[model samples]
Target: MKFLQWITLTCTVLIVSCTSLFCNMAYVTNEGSNTISVINTATNTVAATIIVGATPIIVAITPDGKTAYVANGGSNTVSVINTATNTVTATIGVGSNPTILAITPDGKTAYVINRNDNSVSAINLATNTVTATIGVGVSPFFLTITPDGKTAYVTNEDSNTVSVINIATNTIITTLAVGTLPRFIAITPNGTTAYVTNENSNTVSVINTATNLVTASIGVGIKPFDIAITPDGKTAYVTNLDSDTVSAINTATNSVSVTIGVSGSRPKLLEITPDGKTVYLAYEDISFVTAINTATNLVTDTIEVGPAPAVLAITPDSKTVYVPNSDNNTVSVIDTATNRVVATIGVGSQPLAITITSNPQPPHSLAGKKKKDIFATQTDRINVITWSAPSEGISPVRYKIYRDAALTNLAGMVSASNALKFEDHNRKNHTVYSYYIVSEDLNGGLSTAASISIS
Candidate 1:
């Protein structure tokens, strides 16, 4: 039998709370309603509607997932929401017409882009106040925080330039000229490169973040509005509003790798799944979310959502997708596994951007275990091993041993109570055999380690 078939099955349960067994919540900023929407991922429902400020154009969640900050363009203030309570805990006054926001990795600071002011506001999370404002190029619309949270890159919409800000000092370190009307920015996972979407030029500028310079320019679709980098940092996805398509950029050569067409009229926002296998694009006019296969660069599914789906966000597990509909004042939740809309949650008007907190998966304890003791008879045959289990209730006492990475030995879960041993008889006498073990919970959460080598 295949390894996937041998795993035990468990009932899937949905839980809604501040602290979910899985990180399953969505934060949406509403521009028309002047508020933000908090959605429960499990139920695909709106838990709360928070009144933030005027024209909340974009929203960003802190790295720790404890708080969400919304940039209100009309009011020039950022509304801080406590994710646990789904309430606005504070209102931080920032620069004029804050259009986008980015938070530091430590979750202690935030950078807000002031479109009209042409400045970035640095907010101290602890005090919920703006500590400094750094001037940049014209119409700084979007900002991206580096992985290390030491710097922020802002895309100047009108100036066709990118500003690099030193987060620690709250100062503009340098500015690099790029394509016309840069609208969105994203940094690679390794923090080595940054990608900027040029709306007017219909291209993306690849910047070397270390030198704060544009290294290359890749032509994409018409009017690229938003951008996201794959988890591996090898590819980037950009949403083209005018062309109703998504452009995939290969980071290695800094060029357009592929383009996936969408059904909707204007594809405004884009997000990538945690596993980096799927990309989600939100269509603003038709109110739909299109799921694209990253490997194939094709639209695999389209999910009907609320009116004017403006933004999209995916949960840490990549099992759920949340979309904010600006026209209908609602948020739609899509179960990725089923490729269907599970629920439509009503919220404030004109929901603009959405983000989710990532839940931590249980650590694999077997990672540090010695291979020789774990697998004596079965080693050298397997190249890879994987284990997964559920996230809650009834701790898995132990795991079953298997020969081969595919677990083709010992039919099913054997009692680990007996020194967690498994033997291999199918292998030749002189041939090497490899073995592996996996621990899982009742909820289908599994943890896996390396394979054991034996001769």
Candidate 2:
């Protein structure tokens, strides 16, 4: 499975280009109505409409497709929706104007961009709570993590800089200055380079991943609002909102090879299909989407969608396109083969953003375990801890070991494939350490912690 990464352009304008492996459902966030429209992709109909916080601008689904985190710009809260139940299970309060959220590849943590407060909240997926908050530059909006899940790059609009964060510690390692008003960012498939769009400077800053420095600044159209790289990482397409054009940049040379003029007034946001065959551009002023052929760099078809189509999401198979229309309070489903609208489903009022689940399956019920056991032994300087899964409940997929009795300090974790064992190397020879073990499943369910003491 391809690692799911978060891509955000701005609070008002953003695009999520994810390679969902088994995507079968689409979740659209309605800004005006403060609700979510869940569309079953197989049936092309609204299966459920869930009410969220006020002015929900963006929504991100976990890689497992079991949970979704919605950023409420108006209420300064993130609504966690359980995909299986189609309901908001928890409402997490974050910084002011929480506009974007990015989940880690393991589905264990989520980092939310609080634009108004200029901070990022790291949420623990297991507990559905904020674990840490890291401060960043002024008016930060754009965020994208590296492919390896080790680093995250954030664009600060007012500061004109990019904050590089270490994923494990959730701290800022460095902040590199970029062009003025960096709005959108894209990292290559190889995790070697990152391309950031400067809205005010009318250029894109290319950064070296190894050095974390601005290596080159390539000039583009009037105002580059959003950017998307092809799956192959050979070319990156940038949408120029003011110039009404799309600039194709060659990744190898870091130069503009071709500039394609778009028909609409403001070509605001765009997304390249996962198959790398087509690029769809959404216009802010017009009611249609212009499809561009990546092979020829030419406009292929202009399909009319609902009025004010704010964002677009293409399915993993590249067979369908889903666009959320903010003005009409509906979603337009387009069949990719024919480039036509197959169905228009009514949703909440003013849908601003949409994200489809990669594997939208029904929720599995996991019974609680009644008994579990853990044993620890000292070998050299390492405390080797092993546990036995309770025979009372369903089979567990992984185990988490905590050092503190509060279970807040994580000691180590071992997957079921790792023989259900964890080694703690930070043990002191003369001190007694209390360890807690919790068994977990793929659906984010945790068993009661079993305690053990080692001296």
Candidate 3:
């Protein structure tokens, strides 16, 4: 008799990216309707519509990929959404005009930047409560956390300075003066430097993390509002809102390498792909998105989306890009392979910010452990392989087992299936055998064996 047993999996607590070996989901905050639209990455459709706090402007997912923290600009509160069910589990009051979110790498806490209150609210992820309220600079609108999860950098628009916060103490340790009306902040992958976009000064201030001082101020186009760094940490792209242009900064030289013009589309914000090959820019008062090639620093193509696109988010595999149109009340899914709008998902009115839940799925195991583990056995004329089918966040859509290490010959398969175990009958006795198992999540994200030999 042939039999296969399925093991249930409990996902890890970290949410920065999907180590859970599952597909990603994009969450978009709708300011006009006090709701959030969840998009399924695979189908590019609205999976769920969740009501949140009033006038939510931005969102951040926890490291465990379980919950989304949303900042309500109008209600002065933060709504915590349970990603598994697409529901707002908690709503905690914050400062006035909470506009931005920066979650720590550890996923233990989230920092909310308040524009009118000149403060930051720290929420404890485990408890869903406001743990600390730290005062920052005047009118802080955007913030970024260090890769190490130790410090946070906030851009103060009214004071023209950047506030540096020590995560351990939840306090503003220092403030460094930058250009006029600093708006957005981004920290490099190496955690050594930070880039702040100064809107009024039309420049990007490069700050040394160790000294907390501006090391270089590279001039960009008019009203630089957003910044994105390449994965390799070699370049920085700044969107100039008024100039309708983007300035590429050479990180090594701390200078502007190229300025690509966006004709008639005032670029408001930009996000880079995971592979760092392209940059997607959202235009103000425009109905389309512009894709820029990072290599040539030129406009590669323009994709027509909805009216007045505001923010952008990319999946972990760099295969798709999500753009939320505030005016048209929808999110456009763009396939990176074609650079075309593959699907138009209806979200909510005035969708503002978007983020993906993330990569790194693991092989199947037996105990539903967060990490990878394997179990198999062979007896006279019978072979059985049983593993804990990772439910991760979403259940595995299908599972496959192979006899060879190369995974060429399909020994068994569960189509549109969730069976975790595979049994091979009529096998030769006293023969050495090897097998490989692969799993796919509901979001269409595949996690395969890194090595041909199943671990």
lDDT of each: 0.72, 0.82, 0.78
**Can you give the TM-score per candidate against the true fold?**
0.74, 0.75, 0.82
Which model is ahead, 1 or 3, in terms of TM-score? 3
Candidates 1 and 2, the one with greater lDDT? 2
Q: Pairing residues by index, what is the TM-score of model 2?
A: 0.75
lDDT of 2 by residue, 1-455 (tens): 22322222111111122222222678899999999988888787888999999999888987766788999999999999987799899999999899988987767888889998899999998999899999999999889888888889999999999999998999999999999999999999999999999999999999999989899999999989999999999999999989999999999999999999988988988988978999998998999999999999999899999999988999866878999988888889888888999999999998998897652221122111111122354233455555566553334567767776566788778777766666666445566666666665554445446666555
How many backbone clashes does every candidate have?
14, 2, 14
- TM-score rank, highest first? 3, 2, 1
lDDT pick, better of 2 and 3: 2
Off by over 4 Å in 1: 1-23, 361-455
Worst 10 residues of 1 by lDDT: 11-20
Q: Model 3 — TM-score against the truth? A: 0.82
Model 3, stretches more than 4 Å misplaced? 1-23, 363-445
